[model samples]
Target: MILIVASLCVQILCAIHVIRSSRNQIWLLFIMLFSLLGCFAYLMLEVLPQHWNNRHVRTARAQVVGKVDPERAVRDAQRNLDLAETAANYIALGDAQAIRHRYADAESAYRKALAMGPGGDWGTQVKMAGVLFERGESAEALRLLDAAPELGMGSERDRRALLRARILADLGRAAEARLLFEDVIERIAGEEARCHYVAFLLQQGDRYRARSILEEVERRAKRMDLTQRAAQADMYRWAGEQLAELRKV
Candidate 1:
């Protein structure tokens, strides 16, 4: 009788835990139906796995959600902003809005982040410039990029240069844009930069060079690690689409 009572107590405790965790309702039934065994199974199969999921799985899920509902992050960031309107949170919101193609909203968010500070946030400045570029405000984008605080030599500088190249391309400064693009393409360039370079070459009637660059990008994409592929799936997809269009030409 004591053993049965202990089993029932364990089952009840497990049920309460699963409920509080907001886990599946089926877990409650399993615990109630099979007592201790059900509780053990539930803990092993669901609870433990939830606690033990690796970074890759979590990151993959986040990337999937970002693609599936890009606005989800924006909503989350907005909630954080409502809770505490911090500069970082506003930047996060701006990033999410930009990802969702809400350039106006993103610009507003970045401006809010900038206004909260003493001055000189190169990252936020770059982001706002990107939004402006997307909205076809290329001159303003150039101004912002030129005004950005120098962050020394590295990915940050490369990204700022890339933005400048894009603005130049849109402004029909092909010679300058091509030079910057070539400089960026020498290193481990992002897919966007690679694709833009290919597009630039195509515009100049350099089909062979454009095709070679696109082929290299596609080849590299095919060899990316699981985490990298997940993070860059959209860029790769866009590249593939562009490649198909190029091939058809």
Candidate 2:
């Protein structure tokens, strides 16, 4: 009888060890094989600790949510700005200054940043491009933007590509710009993207194609909210009015 009891105790200890080690499947298998001993081990280790930690983490997160403040956000932004200024040697101080909307300061910073390197860093390039655009140097901005790739850099890359297409159209390279806009629409695959593409078509006086694209965009926008629906309707109405004006011309 003592030998049987010793065997049962050994099985229970093994089960407990498996549960504590995070081997749930092994614990389950042993419980099924050893019955009551396995069940008691699981109750002691797996179930209790899992519930305890989960509750603790949730409580900690809830407390953290209450500690956020505007002062903290301001400090974080200032820290980021300082870091960006210190680390970005390849770009001009003028460019950095421009990013913060200090146009005169940005112009000086960009010149300095440009002097740091011949090959462009994405941030510096974008800053320079924006300055050129603001100064009405659209051609130079287009050239710089065209040379840059449009991936891996987040929304900045998408915005640059879209802006480049718009500038190309403005510069009378409508065919090339239209093709580029179409590519962007294909890549992004959403109602907003399609609406922009349709607007571009309408701007180019291709009313028929614009109408078709607008119809598709409208269909997709149905799955969105009333605000989105109203915006799309406005786009269509504007496109129609523009098309009519073009016809009169």
Candidate 3:
């Protein structure tokens, strides 16, 4: 009896999702006529694919993979690169390598990408800038970002600003860096930009502002799901630590 109730519940939920999401009317018939099999089909064919393609869902999956098997990403990226030396594959390898802090390997991969078919390309350039920045080649990173003065408009453009701000901070260009960081933080809804600003504020000895920003981040985090929180665990940990210390002062 319990199993039957649960099965009906699933079919009803699937039907609700089908209606709410405006999925094909055929799916409703399938769910109503085929029972559990129909619900499974709708989920696998319709729902799961949609969620899997979402960037947040993809990031969540990547975070889980990184936590469970960090080395697998690098290996998988290399396997893909081995299959095709295309720019996208190389960039994927660079990203995997960068995550492992293998800056030399990442840089080599990015260089190969730059030499290949025009990437999702400027994005590749920005990724290379990140690798260069991580490797302490701040000057080169700045040059790459500067070369592409017009990034049109997107996350990458915002990323460019955030990255440039970090590079400037590293170069002792505090005022310029602060302006860039503030611009990106205020305009973008990304926690990373805000976290970077938090770190920057700490370095500048403005603990008060850092605490305020982190408090805001913490408040915003209340609404996030487990995977989203897990994906940002490091930043959240650091933010918490900073907040605790600031409270002491």
> How many pairs of residues collide in model 2?
9
Error of 2 at 110 (Å): 6.2
The regions of model 1 sitting more than 4 angstroms off are 1-59, 225-227, 244-249
TM-score per model over all chains: 0.72, 0.45, 0.76
The whole-model lDDT of each prediction reads 0.86, 0.62, 0.88
True-vs-predicted CA distance for residue 173, candidate 3, Å: 0.3
Model 2: pairs clashing at backbone N, Cα or C within 3 Å: 91-113, 92-109, 92-113, 93-109, 94-106, 94-109, 94-110, 95-110, 98-106
Lowest lDDT 10-residue stretch of candidate 2: 65-74
Give lDDT for model 1.
0.86
**Model 3: CA > 4 A from native:** 1-57, 118-120
Over the stretch 108-184, how does candidate 3's per-residue lDDT look in tens digits?
Answer: 99899889865446777888888899989999999988877586777767878889999999888999999999889
Give the distance in Å from residue 183's predicted Cα in candidate 2 to where it truly belongs: 2.1
Q: Which of the two, 1 or 2, has more TM-score?
A: 1
Model 2 ranges with Cα > 4 A deviation: 1-119, 149-160, 189-192, 225-249
Best by lDDT: 3
